[model samples]
Every structure is written in C-alpha cells, then in structure tokens.
Target: MVGDAHRAPETAAGRLGRRLLTGWAVLGFVYLFIPIAVIVGYSFNDPAGKFNIIWRRFTFDNWAHAFERGPLTEAMVRSLQIAGIAAIAATVLGGLVALALARYRFRGGALIEILLVLPLTTPEIVLGASLLSLFIDLDQQRGFWTIVIAHVLFCTSFVALTIKARIRGFDWTLEDAAMDLGAPPWRTFSRVTLPLIMPGILAAALLSFALSIDDFIITFFNAGTTETFPLRIFGASRNEISPQINVLATVVLLASVALLLAGVAARARVEGRPVVVLTDTDG
Candidate 1:
C-alpha cells in the first residue's frame, strides 16, 4: 500500500509534464501557422485590403492577374532557373568537398571546414556588399548568372553540412570491404558510399534549391536589371500592396510547404521506415 501510494505521485508528475509539453507544442505550432494562415487568407481577398483577412468578399482576380499580367510569373520562372542551376552547382561542389572531408584527415582540415561554413555565418548584407564590390572590380555583368553564383556560395555550405553529417554517421567498413574485394576507389564510392549517402545529397539539393529560390538580399545586389521573385515583390511593395502580391506570396508559401514535406519524406525513407504515402494508399 505504501509503495503504491509513493508511485502515484510520480505517475501524476509524469502526466503533468506530458500535458505541459503538449501544450507548449500546440502553442509553438499556432505561432508558426497563424502568419501562414493569414497570408493564404489574404491571397483570396476579393476587395483587397492592407490586412490579409477581409470581412467583405473573396475573388480570384488577384491570382489571375499575378499569373497573367503581373511580373510575378516572370520572376517565378527566373527564380526557378537560378535556383536549379545553383542547387546543381552547389550540390556537386559541396558533395565532393564533403566526401573529401569525410574520407581523409588532411592538414588544415578544420580551417577548410571553417571557411566552408563562414559564408553561412556571415551577415547576408555583408556578403552581398562584398560580392557586389568584387563583381564591380572584375567588371562582371550583374544579372541572372551573378545571382546564381552568389546563391551557390552560401548554398554550398548547407549542402556540405548536410552531406557531411550523413557521412559522419556512415559505416566506413562497407566501403573498405568493397575496396578490399578488388573494386576500384571510384567503383567502391559509386556502389557503396553513394548509395548510402544519396538521400542526404538529395535532401541537401532540395534545401539548397529552396534557399536559393527564396533568397532576397544577395540576389537583389547581384541582379541588376534582371528581377528575381523576391526582388519583384520588394519593388511592388514600394508602389502599393496589391492582391497579386498576396497570390505570389501564397505560391511561395505552398512551395515551401511542399519542399518541407518532401524533405521529411526523404528522411523517413533514408531511415528505412515505411513512407506515409504508401501506408495511406494501402489503407
């Protein structure tokens, strides 16, 4: 009886702690979702207002305008093109660097790692100003390619970090076994290491693509006459807060959500769990 009485308080404490955690989680979710919900709601507002929510009515005119007449569509395409190139370039370079870092312990390894991550840690404004100055000095034209190069600089760090983390936790014995069995270094890497780290590489690429697409400050400085999506949005704000802006914002939000879901799905697949999509289909 005494033991049971003593255990009851501990059980109650555990329940209380769980409840507290659940409450905090819900609060955090609300904080994140509220702004997104507001933006989405504002996108559909018929008689556009400063606030996203309207007590008036709903319309699709803004979305139509954004897709058809506004600069939003062109900016979206440009952003996609730049992001695609940046993602591929960053992933290739960063993946190679990560592989080298993981496979070997060279002199100044720590310094190289620090240099790789320095861009990520530096202020965006500072990086943008420095890059702008460099371009001016080199007499390089400021346009789509400049933006792509700027994006690649920072995006590479993200890719390297992601791939390196995966490589760190990887089993090196399998790779050594492959080499020992008369496989070439390239073949061992392709057959063994590549397959193991492919998911991380994919995740890194997706993340880099998203970051490149959504970037503003660096792109703004590098992009002279060529307007990227974020630059267009910022330009538009100077004139008026059009409902078309809301539509573009909604598209960006949706894309971000989709990419996030994809990353989660990929991570789950990497961990060898049955993906949610397949489970839902089976059900």
Candidate 2:
C-alpha cells in the first residue's frame, strides 16, 4: 500500500509532464502555421499602389493579375516545367539508388550511401556555386535545364531517403516467394516490389516536387536567363511588391497544402485505413 501510494505521485507527475509537452507542441505548431496563415490572408489584399497591408483592402484582383499574361505568369510556367522534370528525374534516380542500397551488399556500400547523401548535407550556396562553376567550365548554357539539374541534385537525396525508409520496413520474403514461383527477377520486382513500394515512391515524388518548386538559392545561381516563380518573386520584392505576387503566393500555398493532404490520404488508403471514417464513435 505504501509502494502504490508512492507510485501514484510518480504516475501523476509523468502525466503532467506529458500534458505540458503536448501543450508546448500545440503552441509550436501554431507558431509555425500562423505566419503562413497571415501571408495567405494578406495575399487577397487590394493594391492601392502600396505594399503595406494596413493600407490595402481585400480583393481577388491580385490573383487575376497574377494569372494574366505577364512576366510572373511566364516565370511560373517555367518553374513548373523545371520542377516537374527535376522531380521525375530525381525520383527515378533515387528509386534505383534506394533499391541498390536495400538489396545489395557490396564493397564501400556505406561510403556510397554517404556520397549519395552529400548533396543534401552540403550548404546550398556551396553546391550552387560548384554547379555553376562546373557548367561554366563545361561551356554549358545556364538556363532552365541547369536549374532542373541543380534541383535534381539535392531532391534525389530526399527521394532516396524516403523510399529507403519504406524499403527498410518491407518484407523481403515476398520478393523471394515471387522468385520461387518461377517469375523472372524483373517480373518479380515489377509486380511484387514495385506495388509494395509505390506509396513510398509517390511520397518521394511529392517531396521532390515540393522541394524543386520552392527552391530559390540554388536556382538563382544556376538560372541565367530562365527565371522561376520564386526568382520572379524575389526580383519583384526588390522593385515593388505587387499584389499579383501575393495572388501567386496564395495559389502556390493552397496547392501545396492540397497536395500534402492528398498524399497523406493516399498513404492512409494504401495502408488499408478507411480515410473517410478515421475513428469509431460507438462505445
């Protein structure tokens, strides 16, 4: 009875600690989200030839202007194109690297993994400068293609990491079983392994796309004449903060949020959860 009495206070203390942690976590989330919320809110403000939020009224004219024929729209299209290509290329390369890492044990495997992840750990400015130097040395044009290549360089690491995590948790027995059933290695991989890891691949693709689309510094270094959406935004902020830019920002923000939610929903569905009804309310 004395021991139980002593344990009660300890348990209560643990619960209290957890509650405090939860509260702090909630506050942290709010801190992160509030700024984004404010930005989105301000994106709808009307342009009175001024960038100040206090002097503006709410309007959708900025969004219309952003979408209309302009340099901003052109830059946005260029950005999307570059990002799409980069995401696809990075995902493919990363998938292959993840497969090799997961399935093979060779000499200097650890070294190879480290090398693959080097771009991610290295400072972006250094990497960007190095890429620019290489392009210059090779006498290559610094344009959309260069930006795409730069994006792929870092985005591939994220893809590999995501797919590798998924691959680690996978059952190799399924692959072996497929092989035993007289399926060829390629067939087994395509039918068995690919299906199992599709969710990870999709997640990696989304992550890569987001990274490529949002990248500024590296793209800035590599992009000579070809300007991306973020690059345009940066330039615009220097001259004059246009309401049109806010519209573009809001659109991108909404798209990112929607894509993120969709990815989560897809993952849940793939994992055999009913996304429509998350919990049972019955006692």
Candidate 3:
C-alpha cells in the first residue's frame, strides 16, 4: 500500500512534466509561425493607403498583378540570377572541399575545417563590413560580381559542412568495388560516388540558393547601386509599401513549402520508407 502510493505520485508527476513540455513546444511553434501567418494572411488584403499595413478588404488583385510592380519584379529577377550563380559556384567549391576532407588525411585539415566554419559562426554584419572593406582596399567594384563573391564566401562554408555531415558515414567500399569491376577512377566516381552524394549536394544547393536570395546585410554593403529583391523591399517600405511585396512573399513561402514537401517525399522514397501521416487511426 505504501509503495503503490509513492509510485502513483511519481507517475503523475512525470505525466505532468511531459504535458508541460508538450505545451511549451506547441507555444514555441505558434510563436515562431505567428509572423509568417500574418504575412500570408495580409497577402490577400487590399489596402487603400500607400502602406499595406492596414487591412481594408480581401482581394485577388494583388495576386493577379503581382509582377506588375516593375522595379520589384526586376529586383526579384536580379536576386534570382545572383542566387542561382552563387549557389552553383558555392556547391561546386564546397563539395570539393567536403570530399577532400572526408576522404583524405591531409596536413592542416583541422585548420581548414575551422576556417570553413568560422564564416558561419561569425556575425553577418561583421562579414558584410569586412567584405566591403576588402573590396574597397582591392579597388573592386561593389556590384553583381562582388555580391556573388560575398554570397559564395558565406554559402560555401554551409554547403561544405552540410555535405560533409551527409558523407561522413558513407561506405567507401562501394567505390572500391566499382574500381575492382574494371571501372576507371572517373567512371567509378561518376557511377558510384556521385549518385550516393547527389542528395546531399542538392540539399546544399537548395540551402545556398535560399540563403543567397534572403541575404540582406551582406548584400547591402556590397550591392553598390544594384538593388536586389530584399534591398528593394527595404527601400520601398520607407516610401511606399506595396501589396505586391506581400503577394511575392506569399508565393515564395508556398514555393519553399512545396520544395520542403518534395524533399521529404524524395527522402522517404530513397529510404524505402512510408511517410507517417499524423491522424486519428483508432476506432
């Protein structure tokens, strides 16, 4: 009777702790997503004033005329182009670094890895200022190429780290097997290694693209007179906040969500696993 009484109280306390933790987790998610929900909700709102802050009514006009904002559209296109180029460059360089680090025991390996991670750990504002200063010292023009360089500098570290993580536990015997089957080095790499690592590379590319597109502080210092989408939006907010901004933002959000779902599906398929849907399965 005494043991039973003690166990009952302990069990109750554990359940209470779990419930509290669950509640906190739910609250955290809600807090994080509230601003995003607001952005999505206001995308459909039609405001009368220059500022799109006040909700006037619901309208589809913003969606229909999303790209009608000439400067905004141009800026978005410019940002996309820059992001694409930067992602490609960063992925190539970073993938090489990751491969080298993962496959080899080289001198200064730890130092190199630390150097790669330093950019990620450093403050973006400091990176931006430093890059700006470097360009100034070098007499380099702070424009498209400079923006690309700065983006690649930051993104390379992330890509290298992500790909390295994915490839860490990889089996090298597969590559050896391919070579043993009379395949040349390049052939073995292409047929065996590349396919296995492609998912990580793709993930890194997508991440780099997203980061490049969303980057503001670094671009701000290095962009010179060139206005990317983020810069344009920041400038526009001061003078005239457009509903088109919200529309574009909503579109990007939807696209990102779609991509995330696609990635999840792809991963599930690759792992030969069924996706677990959350629902009431009980009768």
Off by over 4 Å in 2: 1-6, 10-23, 50-54, 64-66, 273-283
Looking at model 3, report the run of 10 residues with the lowest lDDT sum: 274-283
In order of listing, the candidates' clash counts read 0, 0, 0
Each prediction's whole-model lDDT (CA): 0.83, 0.82, 0.90
> Pairs clashing in candidate 3?
none
Clashes (candidate 3): 0
Candidate 2, residues 140-196, lDDT tens digits: the string is 999978898899989899998889988885667777877787779987777777877
Instruction: Please provide, for model 3 over 122-221, each residue's C-alpha lDDT reduced to its tens digit, 9 standing for 90 to 100.
Output: 9999999999999899998889999999999999999999999999978887778777877799877776788788889999999999999999999999
Candidate order by lDDT, highest to lowest? Answer: 3, 1, 2
Q: At residue 196, give the lDDT of candidate 2.
A: 74
lDDT per residue as tens, model 1, 1-283: 4668556456788989999999999999999899778777877777545534454677777776767755778888889999999999999999999988987879988998999989988999999999999999999999988998999999999999889987795667777777787779987766667767788898899889989999999888899899998898788776656666678788877878897888788777667854222112221
- Weakest ten-residue segment in model 1 by summed lDDT: 274-283
How many collisions between residues are there in candidate 2? 0
After the best TM-score superposition of candidate 3, give how far the Cα of residue 245 lies from its true spot, in angstroms.
Answer: 0.7
